[model samples]
Target: MAECLAIRSALSSALDLGIQFLSLKTDCQVLAKAISSKRTVVEVHGVISDIFFCISQLKGFTCSFILRAANVEVDTLAKAALASYLVIF
Candidate 1:
């Protein structure tokens, strides 16, 4: 559920930036598959719907899953950012 919200947030940011073409890579396979298939489980249905709506506004987009090992850098960066936010708060 958090992963879906994260993807939605990223997509929303890209859209806000007027990005026409975007490729989203996620380490969460289930969320990736849900986005690709357009069939989401109950807990994420609303966010998935929002994501599909966002995708419709884009000229081109691709969502895929990567191995967590390959996503370490991004994970580290996100964690660091969150930690900084916590410290600031």
Candidate 2:
């Protein structure tokens, strides 16, 4: 669920900024697969729907899953934000 929200927020920002192309990277394999398949479990169907809608609006979009070690910087930042109870994009 957190992964879904984060991706949605990023996509929303890109749309707001008039970005025509986007490459999204995630360390969560399930989330990446869900997005690629355009399907979500019942618990997060709404959020996934929103993500799909955003993808439809984009001229080009790519969502990829990377190993945790490959995304250490973002992983650290996310942890820091959680520790501080802050929202990050």
Candidate 3:
């Protein structure tokens, strides 16, 4: 569920930036497969539709799954962002 939301947020940001092409990677296999195969599970059906709508607006898009170990940098950045957000509050 979090992965689906993150993907939606990322896509929204990219579209806002007028990005026409994108290659998105997710460490969550289910989310990755959902987007790649254009099939939605019951858990993320609504979000998947939103994601597909965003994809239609782009000239090119690809979503793939990466091993969590290979996604260390993203995890680190997310943790740092969360820490900063907590401090702000």
Arranged by lDDT with the best first, the candidates are 3, 2, 1
Q: Residue 34 lDDT in model 1?
A: 82
Model 2: per-residue Cα lDDT over 19-38, one tens digit each: 98999898989888888887
Worst 10 residues of 2 by lDDT: 80-89
Instruction: Show model 2 residue runs off by greater than 4 Å.
Output: 76-89
- Candidate 3 yields a Cα-based lDDT of 0.82
List, residue by residue over 4-45, the lDDT tens digit for candidate 1. 666677789999999989898888888888888877678778
Model 3: which residue pairs collide?
Answer: none
At residue 79, give the lDDT of candidate 1: 64
Better of 1 and 3 by lDDT: 3
Model 2 TM-score (2 dp): 0.80
lDDT of each: 0.80, 0.81, 0.82
For each candidate, C-alpha RMSD in Å?
Answer: 3.3, 3.2, 3.5
Instruction: Indicate which candidate wins on lDDT.
Output: 3
Residues 1-89, model 3: lDDT tens digits: 55666677778999999999999987888888888998888987897899999999999998889998999887566566556556777
> Once superposed on the true structure, which residue ranges of model 3 sit more than 4 Å away at CA?
75-89
Provide the TM-score for each candidate, comma-separated.
Answer: 0.78, 0.80, 0.79
